[model samples]
Target chain A: MQELKDEVKKLLEQGSIAGFLGMIATTSGVVPHLFVADKADEIEKLTTGDVRYSLVQILRWIAVRHPDDKFGIMCRACDERAMTEMFRNSQLSMDKVVMLGIPCTDELRIACECEEPTPKSLLFGQSTAKKWDKADVERIDAMETEERLDWWTEQLGKCIKCYGCRNSCPMCFCRVCTLNDDPLVKRGEIPSEFPSFHLTRAFHMAGRCVDCGLCEEACPMDIPIRTIYRKVRLVVGELTNFWTGESKGKSPLAELGDGTFPIQ
Target chain B: MADESGSPFEPKIVAFCCNWCTYAGADLAGGMRLKYEPNFVTVRVMCSARVSPHFIIRAFQEGADGVFIGGCHIGDCHYVKGNYITAKRVAIMKRLLEFLGIPKERLHLVWIAASEGDKYAREVDAFTEKVRAMGPSPLKQVRFWKDATVSKKIYKSEAAAETPAGA
Candidate 1:
């Protein structure tokens, strides 16, 4: 933990980055903070807690406002994947940012049900084993079509339309969201019109959702939103052989080319 | 559209057809007098890629029992590779629909040429029957229209009750 603080302090002293985005241990809990170069002493308060936030989204907010400045961010594997996806989408430029990758702890790894708990370039901590169980996906797949429909209706019926999932997702950077579009998601409708609201979101997450599980955590209703997105990821994989943020490559859905997606 | 007892269920379908291919094929079908279901409402676009996923979702939300997207063949797109993107979008949209428990068969993507008038008629007939079998969209069962009507009534009564007796 001290090593991380010292590393950021050195980067700050050398003027390598205008600001560093990381979590700070507050009296209540850990919260995201941007430590500027002049206030290097604040690095002491920085903490790597089990709690996760959309630091990549925060980076986007910072980058768009200050395009000329170089920024550094503490990234988990999912955060790195989100960054790569945003970069591929031309939402952010990798050249203007530095990633300080932090490996997830064992507790966090299990809690998140993560496959890859460590970033590609790890600056600190030990990498945990991958947990790729798809019991939730399999459980839904096993149900009859009618039963599945009823199940989803019941599950999605609990939605309060808070948009917490979208707000917390690092990959959802669209300025004008389709969720707010009056035609797609009707205005002032609680639970927001069955499958359209949820399915639209799931479809948009196709080649972009990096299995961050943040959406599920942020949901007030505890909807297994990530499971739905996991299925989407699988479908995208089967259809286009593209995994979200598996490589620093563009999304297959973003561009059109001959024979890239042969009609089956 | 009526049956023995009452009006039979005629499923509403939304078809998005590319101007260069499917729309022309549909026009040809009309010229040939090829009988097809009248339930389908066609929206013409320049390219298949113009039919965004939101359009399809909106169609379903607006009470469409099925959505039909027709584009030119992969190598024959008027806009070079418009159909290619369409294929990817449809594939993902179909999977998403299935995941959400909406029958995957409710959404259909077909390659139709301007010359294939008979094929266009046949495909429309088949899709209409499939949607008919699927019955009303699950969204309809939720009674969104009823909610809107009820809310409007409540607002009207509230306004009337608040009005001054002299006025």
Candidate 2:
């Protein structure tokens, strides 16, 4: 923790970054904060813990508003992947931002069912080798067609039309979201019409979703949204051999390629 | 066409066909009088890639039991690689639909050349039979406007009653 604060303070003092985006442990709880250079002394308030916030989303907001300013973020493995996907999607410029990667705690690793808990660069915390459990995805895959439909419908029925999943996603940077599109999603509905809202989002997330698990975390209804997206990722991988945020090139869906899907 | 019961389930399938390939194949099928299922209501686009995932979702939402996408064969796309994009989009869409409990078979993507009229007719027949067994889309059963209409009626009456008071 001391090393992280010192690094951030040094960057601030050196005028290397306009602001350092990290989590601050307040009395209310852990919240994301932008520690600026002027108040480098307050870097002591910065802390890395079990609580996860969408810091990359905050970085995008800050970067777009302050395009001229160079920013740094306290990023996790998922955050790094999210940033990579966002950069691939033209949402952020990698050259303008610096990533101060942090390894996730054991509690966070288990809770998130994270495939990779530590970022490429380990700046703070111990990097633990945590393997993700694919039992949930496999369980759904084993269900009968009708049973799977019933399970998803019942699960998605709890969606109060809250866009927390979209709002929390770091890769979701569209100016006008299709989830809010009246013609597509139909406004003024609680559940937003079954299968349409969720299915549309899953399809859109096909090659774009980084499997960050933020969308699932932000869902008030606990829809297991990440599972749906995992299936999407599998499809994208099977069809194009491309995983989101894994490649520097654009998604196959976004670009023309010689590769063909094995459609019988 | 109505069956013996006068209302046998006939799946309403929406087929998005590329103008350069599948659309011309359908025209040739028409010219040859090749028999194909009437379930397919075709929407011709310039290229298969033009049919976005939104269109497929919207088709199901608006009561399409299944969606069929047809494009030129690989390396034969009029736009060079438009069909490749279509293939990727459809593959992802199919996987997503399957995850959502909608059978992946509900969405079909095929490569049809302009000259393959018989193949187009056979593919449509096969897809129609497959979708017919799957039943109507679950989305079609959802009453999207039920609450909206009820609320609209209430608001209209309240506004009508307030007219005299306001004046």
Leading candidate by lDDT: 1
Query: What clash pairs does model 1 have?
Result: none
lDDT of 1 by residue, A131-247 (tens): 778888889988887777767766676778899999999999988998898856776677457667888899889888999999999999877888999999988988878888885
- Candidate 2 residue lDDT tens string, A143-235: 987678767766776678878898888777788898888978877676557678888888878778888888988998778888988888777
Stretches > 4 Å off in candidate 2: B1-7, B135-167
Candidate 1 lDDT (Cα, whole model)? Answer: 0.84
| Residue pairs in collision within model 2 | none
lDDT score of residue A114 within candidate 1: 74
DockQ of structure 2: 0.33
TM-score of each: 0.89, 0.88
Docking class of 2: acceptable
Error of 1 at B152 (Å): 20
